[model samples]
Target chain A: MDEDAKAVATALARESAADGLRRLTDLLLRVADDDPGLAAIAQELDRITEELDQITEELDQITEELDRITEELGASDDGRRPVGVDPVAGRANACAPPLEVWCLPDGTAGASGSLGITYQGPRGLVHGGVSALILDHVLNVALSEQGPAAAGGELSVRYHRPLPLYRNFLATGRLSRGADGELRAVGEITVAGVVAVSAARIVGGRGVRM
Target chain B: MDEDAKAVATALARESAADGLRRLTDLLLRVADDDPGLAAIAQELDRITEELDQITEELDQITEELDRITEELGASDDGRRPVGVDPVAGRANACAPPLEVWCLPDGTAGASGSLGITYQGPRGLVHGGVSALILDHVLNVALSEQGPAAAGGELSVRYHRPLPLYRNFLATGRLSRGADGELRAVGEITVAGVVAVSAARIVGGRGVRM
Candidate 1:
C-alpha cells in the first residue's frame, strides 16, 4: 500500500479503538444502576478488560525486553561493564531501583531519575502517587548513602505539574539535615527537564539494609 | 491423625518454608558476584520468580471469584434491589437493590467500604498516594453531585494515621465552600469507625477527555 493509504488505515484503527474505549467507560459509569441488562454488558466488558490487560502485559514485556537490549548495547559501547543495579531487597522500600545505584560512582551522593508509565493521570501521565513512589526510592537511596538516620520517617509530595506519560523523564533527590535532628530529603520527577512531582521527607527511624 | 501430630506437622512445614525463603533471599543478594557457580543459582531463582508470579495470579483470581460470589449473594437477598452503588445518591435511592447505586450517607465513610481493598499504610496506612486516589474518586463523585464549577483547582490529602487494611471499611466526602472562588472537598476513609485516610482538593481546568 502507499504511505497515504497506510496512514489512513492507522487513523481508522485508532479511531475505532478510541470509540470502543469510550463505550466501555460509559458502560462502567452506568454499572451503578443495577439494571438486569448489565449482566450481558458486564460479561462483554469483562472480556474486553481481560484483552486489554493482556495487551498491557505484552507491552510491558516488550518494553522491558527492549530496555534490556538497550542496556546491553549501551554496556557494550561503554566497554562491556555489567550494569551495577542492586536487586531490590524488600517491599519496605519502593518497588523499583534507583538509576544511579548501578551507573554512578560509590561516592556519587546525588543523582536523579524518573519513571514513565501509562497509568498516570496528570499530563495524561504517570500518577502523582507513582511519582511519589519514585521519589521515596530516590530519597531512600540518598539516605542510605548519607549514613544512618536516612531511611524515611515522613514524606511530603507536592504535585507541581501533571507529569505527561511521554518518555524522557527524570527524578532527582537530595538529603540535608532538618531542624529536629532529622534528615530532610527532597526529590522531584521531571518530564523534559520540567518539574512534575516535587516531594520532601523527614527521613528518620530504623535503617534497613538496602 | 492425632491433634498433636497435626500441629507438629504444621510447625515443621512452616519452619522449612521459612528456612527456604531465607536461603532464597541470601542467594538473591549474592547474585551479582562473578562466581562460577552463580549460573545454577540464577536458574533456581528464575524458577522461583516464575512460581511466585503464578501464585500472585492465582490469588488475584481467587479474590475476584470471592467478590463475585459475595455480589451474587447481595443480589439474591432481595428481588427488587438495584445493582452496584453510587455513594452520592443517598439512602432514599436504595431498596436493598442488587448492584444498586446508593449514596453513602455522609459521616459513615471508611476504607473497606469504598476502596474494595484493605487500607495498607500512612507511608498513614493506605499509602498517601492511595489515599489521594480514593479521595480523588470520592471527589469525582462529589463533582458529579455538585454542578460544574467555572474552574477547579488543587487536591490536598492529609494523612492522619496509617490506614489499616481491614475486612470492612467506609468513607464520607463533602463538597463545601472555601475562602475566595475555590471549592473545598474533604474525604475520609475509615475502618470499623476509625479514620484511616482523609483528603481535600480544589478542582480546576478543562480535563481533556481521552
Candidate 2:
C-alpha cells in the first residue's frame, strides 16, 4: 500500500482500539455490585489486567519497530505544527470524541458529534472541560480557515445548561479579525437545539498584538 | 472480598487498563514511517486489533455479569449523581491525568500532576482544552471543599504561555463566597514557578442566581 493508504489504515486501527477502550471504560465506571458475584467479577478483572499487560508488552515492541522506521524515513521536525496528525481531533486519540467539522462560506465553521458515557463528568452530563476542548478545537479550526496560523490566547466558556451524555450536539464557530489585529472567535455548543455551552476566544499570530 | 475492597480492586484494574490504552494511543499517534518496515508494523497492528476484539468480548460478558450483580444489590438510581464512581477524577478513569489534590490549611486546594504525551496538542504543548479540564476539576474541588455542592456557571481561562507536555505542573485554587451567595473560584496552573494558565470561575448552588 502507498504511504497515504498506510497512514489511513493505521489511523483506522487505532480508532477501533480507542472505541473498544471507551466501551471498557464506561462499563468499568458504571459496573458495581455487593452480591456474591463480586468475587467472580474481580477474578475476571484480574484476568483482563493480565491480558492488558501482555498487550502492553507487544505494543512496546511495535513502537520500537515503528520508531526505527520513522528514523529511516527522516521525517522533518518543525516542532510547531504536527506533521500529519492532530492530537485533539485525530482518530487515534481515544480521549477525543469523534467530531466532524465543516467550513462554512461565511468564515464560520460547524461541527457535530454524539458524545457517549465515556465523556460523562457530572453524573449524566458531559464534562464541562470536554466541552471546552471541543470548542477550543472548533474555534481554532475556524480561525485557521479564515486567517493565518495562531496560538490560543484567552478562552472563556459559559455553561447555559447541563449537556446530557449520549446525545447529539452541534457546535458552530465564527472568526473575526479584531481591531488590534488579533484573531477573535466565538463558538457555541447546542444540544437538541438548545444552547448548552458558549465560548469566546482570542488568538495571537505573527502580526497580531498580544 | 468485601464490597469496598471489591470496589477498590475494580477501580485499580480499570486504571491499569486506562494506562495501557493511553500508552497505546500515544504510540499510535507518534508512529509513522515511509520505510519497508511499514508492512510489519501494520501486521502487528492487525494482531493488536484482533486481541482487542477478544478482550472486548470478554469485557462484554463481564459487564453482563456485573449488571446482574448490581441488580441483585438493589442500587439506587439517582441518575443525576453517580452512585459510587466519578468519571472525571476517578482513579479508574484513564482519560484523566494522574492528578493529586490536597486541601491546604488556608482553605485552598493544591493539585500536582505530570501530563504525558497523551495530552499533547500543538506540537509539544499540552492541549489547550486539557488545561481547561484540569483547571476546572481543581477549581471545583476547591469550591466544594469550602462551600456547598455547586455546578459550574462560567469559566474563563487565560493562556500566558504554552504548557509543555510530559512536565510536572502545580495547580492551586481558592474559593470565595460572593455576597450573592454564589461560589467564586480562582485557579492558576504553573510550570516551574511560571504561571502558564490562569482561570476564574463562578459556580451556582442553593440561593445563587444564574
- The top-ranked prediction according to DockQ is 2
DockQ of each: 0.04, 0.35
Error of 1 at A6 (Å): 50
Query: Judged by TM-score, which candidate is best?
Result: 2
> What TM-score does candidate 2 reach?
0.78
The clash count of every prediction, one per candidate, is 48, 0
Q: Write the per-residue lDDT of candidate 1 for residues B20-131, one digit (tens) a residue.
A: 2222222222222233332434444344444434433543453355345436545332333222212122221110001112244452222234321112222112334444
Where is model 2 more than 4 Å wrong at Cα? A1-5, A33-87, A176-183, A204-210, B1-5, B33-88, B176-183, B204-210
Docking class of 2: acceptable
Residue A33 displacement (Å), model 1: 20
For residue B207, model 1's alpha carbon misses the true position, in angstroms, by 21
* Cα RMSD, each candidate: 17.8, 5.1
* lDDT, model 2, position B189: 94
Give lDDT tens digits, candidate 2, residues A1-210.
Answer: 776786665556556666665556565555543334446556655665566556556656655655564565454222222233454576556666767767777778777988766677766788787888888778877877765644757777888888887788999889766666766888799988899988877774332111
